[model samples]
Each structure stands twice: as C-alpha cells, then as structure tokens.
Target: MSNVLRIALVDPNDSTREMLKAMLLGMDTVWLEADCSRYEFFSDIIEQTAPDVGVVTLDSDEDRAIALVERLSKEAKDTVILAASESTDGHLILRTIRSGAREFLTLPVTKDDLAAALGRVSQQKFGTADGGGRSCEVIAIAGATGGVGTTSASVNLGCILASDSRNSVALLDLDLALGDADVFLDAIPDYTLADVVQNISRLDIQLLKQSLTKHSSGLYLLPRPVELHDTASITDESLRKVIGLLKASFSHLIIDLSKTYSPVDMAAIEAASRVILMTQLDLPCLRNVVRLMMSFEEIEGLQSKVEIVVNRAGLESGQISLKKAKETLGREVYALLPNDYRTMVEVRNNGVPLITQAPKAAITQAMRDLAAKLQGKSGGKVEAEPDKSAESKWKKFWPGAAKS
Candidate 1:
C-alpha cells in the first residue's frame, strides 16, 4: 500500500488526456481516479471518484470552461479545481481565477510546477493560509447634476484615505462613458473597467491590481471605458461582481457615479457603506437633492447612510446659504467644501490631487476634514443650528419631507 493523492482529469483531447494519465500513473504519490473528454459529467466524476483535485482543460470554449469551474467549485466543495490552458494570455488567467479555479497552469505541464500547485491546495485545505479573509469599506459618491464637483471630491477623498500607510484605497469610475477620474489624477491607464468586466469571470485580487493605474498618492484607479460603446457591455451583474471583489481586496472602495441612476448605479449604491450625495449651493441642485433624498428614504436603511455634501459652498454672493440650504433639504449638512476656483483649475490642469499639490490650501484641509469624518476620526458637526421655523416651510414645499 502507498500514500497517494486522488486526481480527476477532464480534457477534450484524447491524446493529451492519455498522456496526462500515464504521467500521473508513473508518480508513486498520485492516483488517477477518472479521465473524461468533457466537463459536463464533472459532478458525476467527483461523486464516483471522490477526487481531492480536479484538473480541467481550458481551450477556445472559454465560457464553457468558466461555467464548469464555477459549478465544480460550488458543487464539490471539498475538491479544488485547477484550470490548464495552452495559451498564457493574462486575460485568460484572470478569467480562470474569477471562475473559481484554485490555480491555473499552462499546458505541457512540468512535474515540478504541478507539485508546487498541489502543495498550495493542501495548505489551503488544512487552514494554514495567512490573511485568508478580509473585508473593506465601500463608499459611493454621486452628484445631483453635472458640474457639482463629484469627481473632484472623490479623487481628493481617495488620495487622503490612501495617505495612511496602513490603508489601501481603490477608486472606480462607474460613469463608464463620461468618467474623468483618471484626468483628475493625470493617469492614462492601459486597462480600464471594460477590460475588467469583460474578463470578470477570471478576476481576482492580483488581476484587479494589474488592471488598476496607481497614482503617486498611492490611490488605485479603475477608469471608465475610453469608448462610449464599451459602456453597453458592462452589465449590472458584472458591476456588482467587480465591486464585490474590490471590497474584499482593498481597505477603501470609492465609486464616482454618473448623474443618471441606472441599474448599475443602483447596485453600487446598494453595496456602499455610505453614499455621499454631492450638491452645490444652488436652487436646482437643492431641489434635486430633495428628490434624491425622498427616493433614498423609500429604500430600507438607505436614508440613514446618506450624507449630504455641499460642494463649492459660499462661492457666489447670490447662491443659497448653507443655513437655508439645510432647511430646504430637511437634513443636516454633512460637510461644507470651500470654493477655490483658481486652485481647482490649477489642480485640474495639472491632473494632481489638491492634497498632493497644495497640501496647506483651505480646500485641501476641508477635504482632509471630510475624510476624517468618514473614517470616524472626528465627529462631523453641523455648522449652524436647524431653524425650527423653517421645518414648516420645507413641509409646504414638499409635504412628504421628514420633519427634523
């Protein structure tokens, strides 16, 4: 009697499967349990053979391969799936990982590489892996309308969060077609969110990091697609999966959303720990904020997580005052960002975050304060007391407004 590892092989090529079986038979520590030409019977093979490991060949049929891996991972919980492919394309490797493969190997496999891969599987099975599970806080930022400084705020906030050495931050430009987050950081990423979504089935922490463009401030950005047509390929399910993976891998996840509330936008909102609703000190922006708040209130527990951010506060003389704005919206102002037009323009032109270029600027300090409040480092205070008299006025404007 000899100690052996039970293995199951699934390959469409007859000759390749036979060769692999012969190689495994030659190894005293390995036991060939089953061999097949297709993955459709993988469940039956797993039940009959009780394989400790399942090696499946991935060829031109990528969708079928991915589905097989996913099903095996879910159905045969005790068995680990190792995907093998002739092509060493990065996208293919990523898709394999996303499809729930425990490991990926290139074809014409060597015994040493095979042994190393199996070693890891054994370690994971015995619970000796370090930092096996971790979670991250996800924050979603949305503007009431265009030019409300939503992208600017998100970039600065992400930079500030990443400033902490212990924290890892990722900023996702969910606007898809019209995102400018990369421009704010002055980064021209080779890979965008479209690349990630297209290969979403293979997405893992390593693949995600590869797709992101890193900034000098240590923030990672997943930019929007360069072409508008690519946006159509991004589905709500894919967005959720990408966001879910980001949440698991980073310390902070920031999403900059377009003004329109598409299904994908709603999915991001649902995943967010807090939704920063950005607005300006203007009548139209204020009215839109009220309407958004009413909609959020309809969703269970969403209203409580919303924090109102008044961007470009005190910019113009005729703009709505923060005091009156709060009364009109029937909620406390979460934070006030100062208006610094010249500095903003310079920062935008330079494609650098305000925190990095002008660290001591008032606007930068305001951004820092907001970050601290979000991280629970400071208790965010309302600058002015709510006017009880204005409560009636808000009700008159919108009878459904919640009384403060």
Candidate 2:
C-alpha cells in the first residue's frame, strides 16, 4: 500500500462540507485531518492539522476559494491546495489554476480523481519518495465510423487485460450521450459518469468504486449517463479530470469513444498512450481512416501513436484487402480481428466477452493476440504486401502534405 495522503476540507455550506467529510472518512488512502465551513479560521485549522492536502470548495464563492488557495500557498507552503467548483467554464478554471491551486476539480469529485490529483501533488511536493513510482497507461479506442466494433474491442480488451492478476483495468465509456459499454458487459450501474461529475467535489476512490459496476472478471466500468440531456453537463475540463482520475486509479485505462470528434474526444485521443483506430475493411471505412489520419497528423506527435486495427478482417471477399488498407493508411496494421458473427451476437445479447462465451473461437484468440501485442509480450507484426499504386491514390487525399 502507498503512503496515506492527509487532507483538510473547507467548504461554506454545511451539507457540502459534511458530504466532503464523509467522503474523506470513507477512503483508506486519505485521512481527513481537518474540516471546516468557514474561511476565517482556515489558517488556524491548517496549522493545527498540518495536512498534506487542502481541499477548498469554490462553488459558493470563487473569491473566497481563491483567497484560501493563495493564503495556503503563502503560509503553508508545504500543503498542496486543490480547488473545487461546480463550474466547468474556461475562465473560472483558468483563474483557479493561476491562483496557486495545484488542481481544479469540478464538484461531486470522485475518489479516483481526487486520489489522482493528490498523487500528482504528492509527487510534486515529496517527489517519488512516497508514491512508489506509480504510473498508469491510458489507451483510447475510436472507430472510423459506426458499427466498427470500437466498444466491443474496448470492453473485451479491458477484460483480457484485467484477467491478468497483476493488472487493474478500468473501462471508461466516453461516448457520453450514446455510450453503451455497460450494455455490452450486461451491467446496470448505479452511478454513471454524470453522477460522478455532478458530485465531483465529494468524490473519493471509495465512493467512485461504489458508483462503478464491477464485472465478474474484475473489470470496473464508468458507464455513460442514461439521460441524453445529461450529456450536455459533461464539459471538456471535467472529462479531462475524470480521465486523469481513472489513469491514477487503474493500471490500464481503456476509453471507448463515440464517432463524433468533440473537444472531449480530442482530449482523450491526445492523452492516450496508444489510440486504437478501429475500422472495418470497406471502401467507406478506408476512406474515413485516411481522412482521420490526416487530421491526426495535424496534431503534433499523435500520428505515430495511432494503431490501425482492422476489425472483421476476413469478413468478405470483395472488401478492401489488408494490403490496400496499409497502402491507403500508410501505417502498418497493428492487429486483425476475425469475423465471428455468431459469437459476437451471442456475447452481445448475453452481455459477456467472447473470452468467456467462446474462449476457443478465433475472434477470442485474435483479441488475446492483440492484448499480448499491446503488453509487448509478442514481437509479431502484420506486414502488408507493397502496393505503390494504392499508396499514390491515397496520397492524393492530402494535397500539400510534406513528406516526413
């Protein structure tokens, strides 16, 4: 176990302060050193408790929050200040970040997010001497278009990764309005990502784990909100914070993204250690892949991290060949998943992974192979036959593209 982080809570509202107090008490890794509802005696309380972390709620009064953060930075230089608010507005976040707040958290704070923030704070204050050299790998999965198996690949890959006893995995459904990662796992979670974000001020790892729906295979899921209207509440800052928290808590963070390329989606893709661009072997999908790749190339250093995953690899005779896909995308195919319609349908209906339903199936083996490759256990790479003609045709998509 890592060293326990000591924290003090300061909030104006009685209900909000108590909620934060209760959340702190529930977490084993964090100790509530002091909790108060007034800013007047916050310095005295900090001096008394000597907490490692200070959590100041800014939802009621941003001025007070800013003052408290600035005061703590000046007086108790050793203590790290974390500002909490309900607002995801860029201006407010910028203000808090500028005012010496080590991290800005949206209210209804989850345990994972808070813990992750503390871990970063701890590392900054005490270096790796206390964090035990902890780190997390974030993998984001995106589809070229719909029905390309992005969610399925994310869920199963998470499951496979979690199957290893040493690895702790979390599958985050970032699709927001239309996310169905829970449906694939046959889980009806009590809490969704919206619930966590709305109450981010009070979130802790213990509370977060309670909100997550844990599968039998040890994969924890943070599903998308049920109400479509709730999706509007999810802001890019909050999404980034949530992803940060997930990365802090889980060893392997697998994100299932939607088709749309919103700011939040871009943030996820940008933060990912590897972005699995899932696509089918079809003309439309291939064309879309080329376009998306071009977009990614515009963002510095993202193109090299993208792994092209060709799902339903051998589905039909007339579809785009592997050679053509490599030629069109100008990247090596990372992995190929077989077309197992019956197994996929059965697993989807039953809400289980192919590994559990049909472990002997070729699709299952393909997923395992993918997992192994991702884990760097296998050196095998899919080599495509040279197709200079296809390459030239695809290059026409980017008119002014300079050769790297």
Candidate 3:
C-alpha cells in the first residue's frame, strides 16, 4: 500500500458528517479514522491526523466557511480547501472563492462528485514533493468526444502501469461533476471526495489513504461524485492543491478528463506531463479532437506534449479512414485498436481489464501493446493480427433467443 491522502469534513449536521465519514471509510486507501468537529476538537485532529485535504459545509454565517478556507489554506499550504453549500447562491459561491476555497459543491453530495474532486486533489499532489518541492511526471487522458473509451483506457492503463513491480501508480477520475469509476469497479465507497474538501486545514498521508479505493491488484482509484450539484462544492485552487499532493506520493499518476472542458479539466491539463488525446473515426469525434488539439496548443507547454490515439481503428464499421484522419488532423496517429466487441463487453460487465481476463484476445493484446507504447517500450515481438471478425461469436450466444 502507498501513502494515503488525508482529508477532513466539517458538516454541522451530525447525520451529514456521519454519512460522509461512512462513505469515505469504504475507500480502502483512505483512513477516515479521525473526526474533528468542534473548534477545540479540530486542533487535536489536525495534530493527530495532519490531513492533506479539508472539507467544510457552509454554515449559517458565510464568514465561518470563508474563515475556515483561509485558515486551512494558510495552515496547510499544500492542503486543498473544499466548501459545500445547501443552496446555490452566486454571491456566496464567489465569496467562498475569494476566501481561498478551492472547491465548491452544492448540497446533497453524490459518490461520483466526491471521487472526481478527490481524484483531482490526488493527481495535483503527484509531480510535486511534500510541501510542494519536487517535480514528477503526470499523465492526463481525454476522449475526443463522449464514449470514446477514454475512462476505460485511463483506468486499465493506470492498473497496468501501477501493477509494475518497480513503480507505484494512482488513477484519478477528474470528471469532477459526473465521473463513474466506482461503478465501473463495482465499489460502493462510504466516503466521497466531499470529506476532503470540508477539512482542508489538516490533511496528511494517513488521512489521504483513508479516502482512496484500492483494488486487489493494487490500483488506487479516486472516483467522481455521482451528483452534479456537489461540483459547486469545490474550487479550482483546491483542485490543484490536491493534484499536487497526489504527485508527491505516487510515482505515476493517470488522470481521466471528461469530454467537456471546464476550469477543473483545464487545470489538470495544464499540470499534466503528457496528454493522451483519444479519438475515433467519426467526424464528430475527429472535429472535437481538432478543436482540443488547437486549444491545447495555445496553452503553455502543451503543444509539444499532446499524443493522439485512434481507437477502433479497423475499417469495418467506422466511416473515416486513417489516411483521411491524418490529413484532416495533420498529425500521425499514435496507436490503433481494432473493434473487439466480446472482450470490451466483458470488460464493461466485469469492470476488470481485458488483458487480465482474456490476455490472448485481440483487444487484450492491443491494450498490452498500447500500454507498452505508453511506457515507451519498443522492439518487443508484437502479438499476431487479431480476429476482428470473431466479435460476431457473441451475437449467436445472446442470453435471449430472438424470434425469426
């Protein structure tokens, strides 16, 4: 087990606090063993736990939340400050931001929202040492458009790289408002990223470990909070601080960026060491890729770092050709993956990597090849050409018999 990402929560309501604690406890990597509610009690939790992120719900008096944010950010220079509100008031939200709150989520938090926020917090921590000293490598994965298998790729790749005997990897889901890494992994976490934002003043490795979901294969996941409203609870600065912490603890950090760009996503992209841009043959997907490529080029240090990948590259179903795609984008494709339905479906159902279950399958082999490519490993004997047509085998094995 690697170092944990410490977090704190400060919701006035006892039930809310307890619920948040329980949710955080579900993450095998996060240790929510401490609770600091009272002002006096908080000092002790800070001294004992030394959390890396702090989450605090908005109080009746907005000043308290603002004060908490300022104090936490100063006390824990690297700590991430997350502020939560029951109502969405523009004024209060702005005030929270002005006060140094890094993240903002509306009331009634969900699992996905929490995961994404924490994932950002964790990834930001990566690439930098404790107290923000050392520089490290950070990887960001973004799909050309929705459903381009970016999330699946990011998760599986993180698992593969982290599984390496010599390296430690952390997979962060940065689709802050609507990420689903937990569902994919079949994990129902007790704590969402909400807990971390509520207590930014005192964050430490032990507290951080208590917030992450660890797999049997040693993959650490920071899922997104399920509820959209919970996104308002976090701020951009808070997100960056958390990512810094992640860089500090892990050797490799993989971030899955949602199709849509937001302040949070842009921040992750800016901090990334490499950006894996995923696209398919469809025009819509290709167009988006072009736009993102153009946009990334404008950002400092991104033009030369973007890597393009053409997924489902075979000429069977998709309309666009590799030559046309290259001509249109003016960039060579990094890697190609054939459309293998059976293995992909199994992966969707089991939430495990295809290589782990069906290593010999074409899709599995492609993923292994992709992993090697990402690791910059070349000269290995590539697997034989895959039977892309074998996907039809599953059609005949459908659970329900179709009427002729």
Off by over 4 Å in 1: 1-134, 380-395, 398-404
Give the deviation of candidate 3 from the true structure as CA RMSD.
Answer: 15.8
Candidate 3 steric clashes: 75
Q: RMSD in angstroms, candidate 1?
A: 13.3
Tens-place lDDT digits, model 1, residues 1-404: 01234588898888777777777656534546678887787679887666778999888477887888989888888888999888899998998899889899887888777777776775565432221222367889999999999999999999999989878999999988788999999999999999999997765455678899999999999999999999998988999878866765577999999888999998899889899999998888888887786678678988777888988887768698877877776668888899999999999999989987899999999999999999888965644554567656655555455554
lDDT of 3: 0.70
Worst 10 residues of 3 by lDDT: 395-404
Better-scoring candidate (lDDT), 2 or 3 = 2
The alpha-carbon lDDT assigned to residue 312 of candidate 1 equals: 86
Give the per-residue lDDT digits (tens) of candidate 3, residues 1-404: 23455677776678777877877766634445356555334544555656777787776446766776777777776667788878798998998888887889776778678766776776677532322222345889988888888877887777677668766677788887668777666677766666566555566556566788886657777777667777777667877767766765676788999767788888888888888888888888877776676566567778667877777777586578887766666656777877876667787788776657676877667777777876668764253332335323322223231221
Candidates' TM-scores?
0.66, 0.68, 0.61
Q: What value does the lDDT take at residue 199 in candidate 2? A: 81
User: Given candidate 2, what's the lDDT at residue 64?
Assistant: 78
Q: Higher-TM-score candidate among 2 and 3? A: 2
Q: Sort all candidates by TM-score, best to worst.
A: 2, 1, 3
User: Which candidate do you rate higher for TM-score, 1 or 2?
Assistant: 2
